[model samples]
Target: MRPLVELVGAGYAYEDGPAVLSGVDFGIAEGRALVLLGRNGSGKTTLMRLLSGGLRPGSGALRLDGEVVAHDRAGLTRLRTAVQLVVQDPDDQLFAASVEQDVSFGPMNLGLPVAEVRERVESALSALDITALRDRPTHLLSYGQRKRAAIAGAVAMAPRVLILDEPTAGLDPDGQERLLDVLAGLRSAGTTVVMATHDVELAVRWADDAAVLTPSGIRTGPAGSLLADPELLSSAGLRQAWAPAVTSFLRTHGFLTANAPGPRTPDSLTTWR
Candidate 1:
């Protein structure tokens, strides 16, 4: 599949700060899940901001559908409609009086008809399973509820690509699982999902592909391949994801053949022959 977004030799740096991202070549394919895996300050957020048009790259190219992203007014407007970024913090994104109002904000900003905006808001709320909270005040929602509401806001925009920065940051285990289910539903419905995180387990189990941001630059590959490389993981400031550790243990005990496929999740270890 062709990439919905591509970064070719992209580089960026805050004023007077050393380059946070440099010489990066990457892509997020349409209708797929891509995990941006890296340690804190590994440029994951920077790359995400670049992708979402929040920050322009200081070097190289940022492209959407093979065309360079234009920085002019009309271009930027279209780009915003095409791609939406959900910040890591729910508090940063939600400010409207009520959940429905907050979720309606994006489509309304697009000058959509009131009926269409209402439809989008309802759909988004239903998609995130937060319809019951629609009339509630944003301030009263729990962290998980607020996160879902924030995501509903973005979903209402109906962007071709959804970029999430550290989506699992504050969720409990159940919250994380619910969020993952929503993301999986989005991917199945052909929404391209790109999420930034340091969680190797999430990357291994959820992403169709992934990219690792290292101090040196960015490395892109299949999620499993990247998770399996201990040296690369260490260099990138990541420990081996649990699936691989369990797979190794099973293999060493002669529980599986040398040519057996690796486990994608820790739970799959028991199924190895």
Candidate 2:
């Protein structure tokens, strides 16, 4: 499948500051999940901003569906509608007094009919399993609740691509699992999902492809192949993913055949025994 969006040699930096991202070349196919892995200050957020139209690339090109992205008001507006970004900080994204109003903001901005906007808002809230919090004030919600509300706002926009930065940063384990399920549902519904995170285990289990951002550039490929390499992980400031570590342990202890299929999820580990 052709990529829904792509960056070719894309580079960006703030005024007089050193380049945060340099020579980034990657593409995300429709309905797929891409995990961006890096330590803090590794340019994950900068790359997300470029992908979401929050900032134009200072060098190279960014394209959506084979066309170069335009920077004009109308062009950028269209880009925003097609690719919605949920930043790491929900506090920065959520401003409305109530959850329902906040989630409704994006669709309503599109000038859709009231009924359509309402339907979208309802669907988004239901998808995130946050309908009960619809009328609650944003200030009263827990951190995870506020995060879900922020995601709902992006979902209401119905973008082809959803970019999330450090999506699991503040969630408990249960909340993280719930958010993963929600992301899986969105993938099934044909929304391309791009997530930037420090969680190597999450990337191993969830990503169709993985990209590791470094100060010099990015290295990207199938998730399994990339996560299985300790050298690569070390260079990217990440450890080997959990599955590989477990598999290696089982192999050294003669608990499993060397030809066993690599397990991507913990549930699949039972196959080895």
Q: Pick the candidate with the highest TM-score.
A: 1
In candidate 1, where is summed lDDT lowest over 10 consecutive residues? 264-273
Error (Å) of candidate 1 at residue 19 is 1.2
What would the per-residue lDDT of candidate 2 be over residues 182-219, giving only the tens digit for each residue? 99888888888999988998898889899997655688
Relative to the true structure, candidate 1 reaches a TM of: 0.95
TM-score of 2: 0.94
- Per-model root-mean-square deviation over C-alphas: 1.6, 1.8
Q: For model 1, state the Cα shift of residue 247 in Å.
A: 2.2
Which regions of candidate 1 deviate over 4 angstroms? 250-255
Q: For model 1, what is the error of residue 197's alpha carbon versus the real structure, in angstroms, after optimal superposition?
A: 1.3
Q: Local error of candidate 1 at 13, Å?
A: 1.0
